[model samples]
Target: MTATTSDSTNAYSTPADDGASTASTASPAPVSPWPRRLACTLVVLVWPLIWVGGLVTTYDAGMSVPDWPGTYGYNLFLYPLSTWLLGPFDLFIEHGHRLLGAIVGFVAIGFLIAAWRGDQRRWVTVLAAGVLLAVIGQGVLGGMRVTMSARVLAMVHGCTGPLFFALCVVAACVTGRRWQRDRVLAAANHTQQGQITANPSTGLPADALRSPWMLWPTLLFGVAYLQILLGAQLRHALPTSSPSMFAHTAMTHVATGIFLWLLTWVAWSVMRGCGDLTLSRPAAALVCLVAVQLLLGMGTWIVNYGYPSILESLPGSASYRLASKNLLDAWIVTGHVATGSLILAVSTLLAVRLRRRRWVLTQLPH
Candidate 1:
């Protein structure tokens, strides 16, 4: 008999070699979707939380209750629905904020437990735990803001909300099915270290394989957040400051706004050319959001500080008096606040995605 062997058979001559290939190509462990789903739900609820928080400030009702962890004489949870719904608008908003915050807190606890129990990632579990802790701290800060009537503490509390909300959004994103899928692919391909080798499976262009270019996002997030702080200071400051002092703050804010707008355009230009749809899409959204914010910024001036006094001398301008905190004022200003938070959250999410994708690409073997 003639000794004949197939080419495939000759190639894999040993079982050990085949087994090694299988082991090397194995996917990462599957992530539970439920934990991420719960996190997403928390993200949804937090939006209205920020909106209501803005309304509380819009109406200047942060001190309506004169108490913390409780509503008037009753425990927080037991506060009568009738009283909350029928009370003065400020009290209603203030009390409703507390109630909504409680709900968010409970949901966050559930999210933490789910992530800790269901997630295989130790870091994810740690992050979930941190979110829970942060929520609790937020409530305490809110309470202290009311009880101590501290404006500085109130601003701190206000700023904390956006950061926490961004965290929730990021948690949801990482726990998501797509994220898990990418993670598994990265692991199987040895792309986890963020350095893309010249491998055929990477599918990335030479430019895509470069660093994530994180500096622009960092600058955008920082500038956007600082703008928010300036806004809060302008809106919530005591009315007793000298005109020169107020003018200085106002001028600084305007200058910063101009600089921020320029930076955003530059960031948008870079993102628009990135060739990656993921980066480009969010970058487009960022551009649109900033444009809307500019118009709203103008509206904020029209509503709070009235038509520019310098412009009153112009034709067809003298008929307008500056509107105070009316319905339109509340909506415009509150939307401005909420939109700022949204921008920050978007920036954070984009930054995380870029970092993760780059890290995934890096893990592939050459």
Candidate 2:
């Protein structure tokens, strides 16, 4: 009996390999769809986690529970729902954040299991492992922040959660059917490095891959993460921060936002020029996300700090005093945070697609 195996090209062997010649047209095994599904599910769950986390910070409710891996001496999952739901506003969001984190952790486990069992790619499994570890680390960070009452921990936790979410999104993309199809193309063009030779199949100059613009996606990915860190600095600004310190952090964040917006457009332009819709679509989406995020950043400042002095010259701006603990304020600020994560996620998707462009580009018809 012959054993089935997936090669580097994603081709599979039949059970009858007993010295008999097989047909040249033998079909490959179907890639399992569960890993992508579970990974996508994880992405969906993490979005709410980010929103809840942003709320915890917005309301200064990180210390409401003041315990680790438990809620007021009760097991995390066993916490009384009545008290959690009916508690003080701060307690409700903090405990609810914990519950959501736990849910995300469980889903991460499911995603990892699906990757291990179904996805043949070793890298996908490794990424799933990293995601699981990230989820656990994020939980520990949250608990430590609560137990130690440390604002620094809270900031770190906030920054890392989005990173974990980004990883989940990448996992979803890599485990996708489209990605598997690209693997087949990559296997064929695996050795086309630095070759000016036209790809006989696509009738396109293969030298395009050698361009420096290939690094744009990578640069965009870094800028996106940096923007998230900068946002964290502002979001978790210490109570004792001086006016100048706050101004400096805000200015840096603003500058980075502008740069990130420009970089996203550059990436989109590159993708469009190549006519790779797989990359172009996400790149375009990333451009839109960055635009919305910039607007949200402006909205976040207005809601949190009221209008800038320049805005005071505009009608109705003079009357804009930031309401303390306003509902709209909370939503705007949280939406800003959530949108940053979204931008990072979309950037990750585009970056991964670009890195895999060897196969993606090969599939494009001339």
TM-score, predicted candidate 1 vs. hidden true structure:
0.83
Candidate 1: misplaced stretches above 4 Å?
1-30, 181-206, 212-214, 238-242, 313-316
TM-score of every model?
0.83, 0.84
Q: Using TM-score as the measure, which candidate wins?
A: 2
Q: Give the Å error, residue 5, model 2.
A: 6.8
Worst 10 residues of 2 by lDDT: 11-20
Per-residue lDDT of 145-223 in model 1, one digit per residue for the tens?
9989998888888889998988998888777654632342343233344343333433444334346464677788888
C-alpha lDDT values of all predictions: 0.73, 0.76
Off by over 4 Å in 2: 1-30, 182-207, 359-366
Clashes of each: 8, 0
lDDT of 2: 0.76
